[model samples]
Target: MKIRSLAAPFRSSSRNNVLFLSTVFLFMAYATDAQHSAKGDMATEQKIHALISEMTLPEKVSLLHGNSKFNVSGIKRLGIPEWALSDGPHGVRAEVNRHDWAYAGWTNDFATCFPPGTALAATWNPALAYKQGLVLGEEARFRKKDILLGPGVNIIRSPLCGRNFEYISEDPLLVSKMAVAYIKALQSKDVAASVKHWLANNQEEHRDSIDVTMSERALREIYLPAFKASVMEGGAYTVMAAYNRFRGEWCSENNYLNREILRKEFGFKGVLMTDWSAAHTTVKAALTGLDLEMGTDKKDYNEWYFADPLIKAVEEGKVPMSVVDEKVANVLRVMFNTKIFDEKRREQGRMNTPEHQQAAYNAAAEAAVLLQNNGNLLPLHFDKIQSIAVIGDNATRKHCSGGLSSEVKALYEITPLQALQQKFGARVKINYARGYEKQSTFREGNNSGQSGSLNVNWKLIDEAVAVARESDVVLIFGGLNHDFDTESADKQNMDLPYGQEILIQEVAKANPKTVVVIIAGSPVQLAGIVHRVPAIVWSWFGGMEAGNAVVDVLSGKINPSGKLPFTLPVSLAQSPAHALGNFPGSDLKVNYEEDILVGYRWFDTKKIQPQFPFGYGLSYTNFSISQFSTDKTGYGKNETIQAKFTIRNTGSVYGAEVVQLYVSDPLCSVLRPEKELKAFQKIFLKPGETKTVEMPVKVADLAFYDESKKAWNTEAGDYILQLGNSSRTIFQKVKISVK
Candidate 1:
């Protein structure tokens, strides 16, 4: 099982010797299979095994760690090429130095910046997720990158998680559906998608060492589904281990999570690499199924845990040689899957093409959720408006290059102010005012130079009010920037920072026709002005075309169809983790006291109302659902419950609606959420158009993880199918029996 060393004459003494061995291996490989077949092909696996058999121990060890900052070492004599990786789930990140974190200053590294994960999840359209992934894959390949470390599927456990913008949702099913689509599309372009932060790295506070504890039920039901689907369904090529600990063990070396769950249960055959400097041990990590140790702060490459230390461990019998072989096998498998050996045949992806920009625009335009519009104040008519007041700091701030790892060097970013000026400057007199000032700047792992002054600047507020009084319509773009919603640090609280509440309230008071657009990636406190503002829109960090997407929605060119992926609680106290007093925990340990009830589950189960429920969104037009019914009144556990409904666009405009199907088990042996989203479909319609939608829910999917039985159990009982546009707005309910 151990890798055999080269013969004495064939060693690396001179270039001629190395070239002789490379020619011999290449001839052997071609003789075995002239056409290197695809992955899972018997010929391909045989070629990989043949190559591994000839690789020396030193060569195998080199492949387990980085030779450069973002590259895995390759066997030069054997003609194996190095593997290149990049940061970004939404776009291909700009190139950095070969040995450090500094930018490489390459002009050709610019990429198409698409909307972030939260925005993609809000769309509830897996098709858009696939489209975004296609663009990301093309750009990653254009940069000659083998892997794109993205489509972070970690559940949004809390609203304050610094990286919530990079995650999909609070619910596992929703996360799984979106992740599978993103992964499949990315890999289709021959670029591997590294589904990341494996195993419950939910919160960023104390992430490097905080130990997370949760029930097996919670782990199986609320956390593991998305990762499972990514492997089994998406056929993901790689997984990035988290920086935290799960159940008191570092995720990179945790045997239970990596060996038992990911490798054995889900049958993942891909490489499991560390999340930057996440590796801590050598033998245990390798034996426990870790294939690659990507990044560590060690100045010398040989000092890395998976480099010299790993080879020494194998030589001293501290680690088995079979484990090293296994790791190499995984790496080789990815190389073959991505066609590393056949570069000419691989995809020659183009970067920042018009098609790529269109995909980015599609995601941004479809992901803006209109949270409130009391008197139809939105879809602003340009003819009726004489003077328009645009206020806030976010209106002018560019968001394409702020966050640390996810930053993209976009060709150009269209700010809201710039977009508005380009679209409507001649039609209307648009006056601008910086109603609030940013009090902090984000610097990767540190939050330095943050101002402590929370007091409202009366001077700025008075000036904004005066501008609002003179304008016929005021659009206040107020929300968080990268200073608050970023990686490495969670928000201190859910409050609107930098006197934004006072500024928004004063501006709204001066002009009753005020529309507030919250431009942020994560949830923020909206109770301050939810009632005061006549219109409210939740626009996420909309990548390079942020302003264009928001303006399109505001002008009725594109209807707002995006929904809330996670529950927006009225206050921090109403959240499950906070309500149980166990967030970010004490003494470096956190408990999942809320158990399986993470987001809307706890709110609905405890009868606590959220400000906006999961899947909640408003449209410029109206949608009506009727004739909701199930195929049968009873079915076996294996049968599919075909739920059919009729939806119509009742307004005088084109729009889309997400039809959500939730299941309820009123009398389960164990406590289940009041309702769990089993299936959903986003449907588009023209004015007065009716479409019949059929959503199928399998009876086995309704099963809860019965901890007592150590398995999922679908009890034979009466279940209710509730169909609606959102989680809380059920229009019809039909009862079905599972036997």
Candidate 2:
């Protein structure tokens, strides 16, 4: 059994205090259930109450914090049968095979690796994200897993955060919306979506013990929104607490957050599980609302460490039986809702269906955003571009996918070069080169490498340059690989992982007809090359079928319709979150000096132009915005007004547009952000196609956490609502009064 010493301040064990706490939980469990049943849907609570009433102390404690004994069994409560919970946002990982934990296991070689969260959010197509969720969920269910730890909704607080690729954007609104869709679709297939890294857990370095302290406003507005939305909107069935501490208390046992806020305020009626081995202690974790203790340190609950202590506390009236009941009840409620205990169990099978693969492919394709299109350089007709040169080290390597937990052990990763060759065949003479080698050169492992050494192959680059000069068009595949972006730790610099930048500059010089395709996890510093490169495509870690997807977009088989989910910083130093101080340490304090200025808000408020603004992307067609209107009284009394507009695709080619709406409150008690993302809509259009979109301005959306009032409220004021394709360009605008 695992021995846990209580953290300081929480280590109090006076007999009277223990007894008093026991009575509180005992009464709380029963009284709360009675009151809740009198008001809300009591069906779930009713069954829970009945089960708790009959359970022994050992049974109750067992139900509260232990996993299945069997490695691969489904959820079976009554016996020694094990319950399965798989690792997946994209594909399933072998939890049984311990060796594969470091490197995504080779046990399952055929699992489809889907695009990371950053890429999926860029699509701005919630339906496509949902489809991908369904595909992954189906695979998880087939693996006999009750829950899938996925759809990581943590914000990109820092550019140096190693796990940024595994997460969504810096903006909470975008993260929340995407998380909701991912959760909804995953649960739609009867698989529970375990939306994870609960709160304020951004960086992975020292994550197990690091404490994150931030303004409550920043907490509510930026970090917590995604978790709130995932639970309230997406109806997520399980929540995995992060390894970090928030506001001086470990998140697993943070009463203010887990119990008072999440369970009470957010109304998250789901099972709260700890990140693997995150549990600090049994009693403390239980009292703080930690429902499940994962991993094997504690072994079985019948052991001395758990059973003896738990029973002693209960018998002495120190720990309440009601607290145990509530935890078990929550877990049971999810199982009942998901029908995990049903008599007619569904047959376990492989989820390699064509529909699932096609869904994954579509998601990968849509997530590829066209960053720059000078003189309409993209959608190169195969016939017009007779010979194509695809060059770069990443051109043929598996550079599109990131690592740790989300990694894939695929049968094959169809790279951009291979895809180009397959798509164009003999018609295109695609030449490639390992433009640069990894920083960890074969000669020196980790210690002895010059800071700015270039590992370029001059001969190969010269040959590629010649080929590019001869070919009709050139596609230089480049960008950061999984080594540069992993959950294990953060990267040293935001510059391109290796010598790809040099290759891009040199390649562009040799062949002016070159198009740069960046397969990166996060935005990179593209200073000199932005204006020089004729066309730039931001292909963020496209999945297993990435090759086909890229080729389809390049060949004009599919119109590129992806938007930037996060603001593309010109350089890492320009980012507002840069100077906050080094993370993974409590000594370095963080301030909300930027306040609500995140993503496009930072760029707009500071008037700093990004290389490519948020929600900015190019399609094979052109679009126009017109007929803007607003209603002051349409939203009811004391509510924020409404803004509506019409969009039309003027170009002949079919495409999709992400209609973005921003709201600016002119005056407020607290210095609020200049404008916030109010609403967004994705619509498809053919030649001469047009559609009208209306956005309801909720009074709640405008509200800031008023510290004096000790509540969130919207101060009455005049607001400017703007509509456009991106944050930088507000094409249409209207005024609304909030009384």
Candidate 3:
């Protein structure tokens, strides 16, 4: 599927015309539909549809694939100019040739790396997510990239899911709400946004072939909601299908997901493209609602499937002509919505605005969470603290740390070490040590190391211990990286790797007032010193400027306001997904026995507590929860119970607190979690500021999948809603009856 070879079939100008014309015809059909007739905006859409009808099939297909350097001429007659494709969820990967082009690689100069997706989710503020999206859109437009291939919305199913750092949450509702805001903000800026890795794209192992066989109930309830929210609510302009399969069929060509679910059910009026090299069957994909195949070495799927096999299917009635028209119409619709025809984007500058960089910094700052701060260990006053010791491999190197397509070149990255020095020069003594090195760095050949040896490097531990003894306070930075953490080909247990544990132990021994910061992508087991560490910060590979963001929080320049998006597993053995075995393996038939039970849900349902519950995070300032009560006991079937609480900032400093609300189903036909997160509110308060927050819990929020009943409904019983700062700590509760 070389670009040159794929280009051969699409050479004929006449063939390209057919593809374009067919799409126009379909648009006309939709425009004339009774539904559009009722809508007053039919004239504009109809004109664009009519214009699309004049294009040839090859031209239409060319539009499906974005304008690449190898192609983009067929649609010249339609005046569709070439549009460049670029990368960067953290920062723009615009550099022509950079090292491996991954999280650690150098992005082209000018592209600012913001905090990672999980970091934004850590804020638990959709408004902030939207603001970040607006920044990403501005940056993308400046770089002249037509579509920003980002906002990976895969579920954080397991702590071991390597790419979990890039996704939002274990709960679908929160992820959906956050994603919708992000998409809306990005698209509002006129930059095409792609909500990606559609449906059950949870694991990295055997990702290309793994069969995600969850019951339809789980699919709709847990996995598909965020995607639906992004498209249906956010009006995302594009969607990228995953490299895996849903049920028995490949995701690109899966009819249920692509057609029945995404298109018909959810009404996703946008371009549906395949993940790079993710396309399987050509004609089947088109028939199943795939409008485009991206980065395919230029596979002329149109000639191989559409022009020849596609027409043959129509002739033999195996594939309807209407299907081709639908695909083309969808493509045209995206182009129209993007204003691809009316405006030229080349005039826009590339990575020149300080506003963009500031946005990145703001996003990073907002997403920084203070996971644990016992005895008020954080907001380290530089004047009061004379010395600081930074220890860990993460302290030295910048790891964008995740999986496939995670690479991006940051115009400038503020390493934690660099940021600390920049903010507190000569004023504070800073000692540093590398707690661990990449396993391959110590190996003879490519990456390889024994599992037992993959903890904190022992030699590095001794140096860090010495530094900790001399310093006033110690900051131990260590966590998983792509080499040791990811869903890709390489995977590891959810434990601190290679001597990091030993380093933490030694450092804690040397300095009892030590703070531990994790820089991995997802939650990891922190048993060795979970109880010993006075302050613990879970920093999910905070983006290009992550280093600076971490420094800001540590130094009290920026208050830590982020919250945990996933639960920290006490041990790999206790993880629900672990029982299923290494993902995409164990005979390739792994079942989600936990079913709708995910993250804290599984832990609570099975009564297997985690080291840290989901939504757990400590603040530098103290806050108290009071006045907890529901407005009413019970009402109509759809009526909601409002739980109001007044949160007072009792500490001396300003800070933010996340108020979490959970609902419990006392009894049900199927097994259910003891309590599930129904709603949450993040409030920022100054010293002594008290705010009354209200959260509504509706009957619909209590529904669960009852396998025997084969339906989701609220069981008739007394339901309990608990309001707390974390899953394990319930500060307030209210009992209600569902009729």
Most accurate candidate by TM-score: 1
Please report, as a residue range, the 10-residue window in candidate 3 with the lowest summed lDDT: 441-450
C-alpha-based local distance difference test score of model 2: 0.74
Off by over 4 Å in 2: 1-43, 66-81, 98-109, 296-317, 345-350, 399-402, 441-460, 580-593, 633-640
Model 1: worst 10 consecutive residues (lDDT sum): 1-10
Every candidate's lDDT: 0.89, 0.74, 0.73
Question: What TM-score quantifies how close candidate 3 is to the native fold?
Answer: 0.87
lDDT per residue (tens digit) for residues 1-739 in model 2: 0112222234455544655666677699889998886754567577667766766777766655444421222223553224567777766654444312344344543566678888888888888778877777777777677788888999887677777888988878888888888888888777788888987777765677777777778777788888889988899999999988887788888998899888998898788888876777667777888887665355444442234566777787777877777777887777766667655545343566777667767878898899888888887888876677788777777843347567665535788877887777777566655666565421111212224434665676677677777777888888777766677666666777556777777778877887888887777878868877799988878877888888899888889988888888887767776644444344543344555666677777877878788888889898999998976533433555567788999999899988888888777777677788878888899989988887776767877877677688776667788898888878988876666
Give the Å error, residue 68, model 2: 7.5
Cα displacement (angstroms), candidate 2, residue 605, comes to 1.5
* lDDT digits (tens) for residues 1-739 of candidate 1: 0112333354455646666667788788876674454334777779889999999999999999997889987888999988899997988899999999999999899889988999999999999999888888888888899999987999998898999998999999999999999999999888998999898898988999899999999999999999999999999999999999999899999999999999999998889999999999998888888999887989899999999999999999999998999889988988888888985946788998999988898999999999999899999998778889999988999888877789889988998889889999988999899888887766556555345425577787888899999999999998888777788888777877789999988898899999999988888888889889889999899999999999989988999999999999889999988888899898999999999999988888899989999999999899999999888999999999889999999999999999999999999888899999999999999999999988988899999998889899999999989988777889999999998
Compared with the true structure, the alpha-carbon lDDT of candidate 1 equals 0.89
Q: How do all models score by TM-score? A: 0.94, 0.88, 0.87
For every candidate, C-alpha RMSD to the true structure in Å: 11.2, 12.1, 11.7
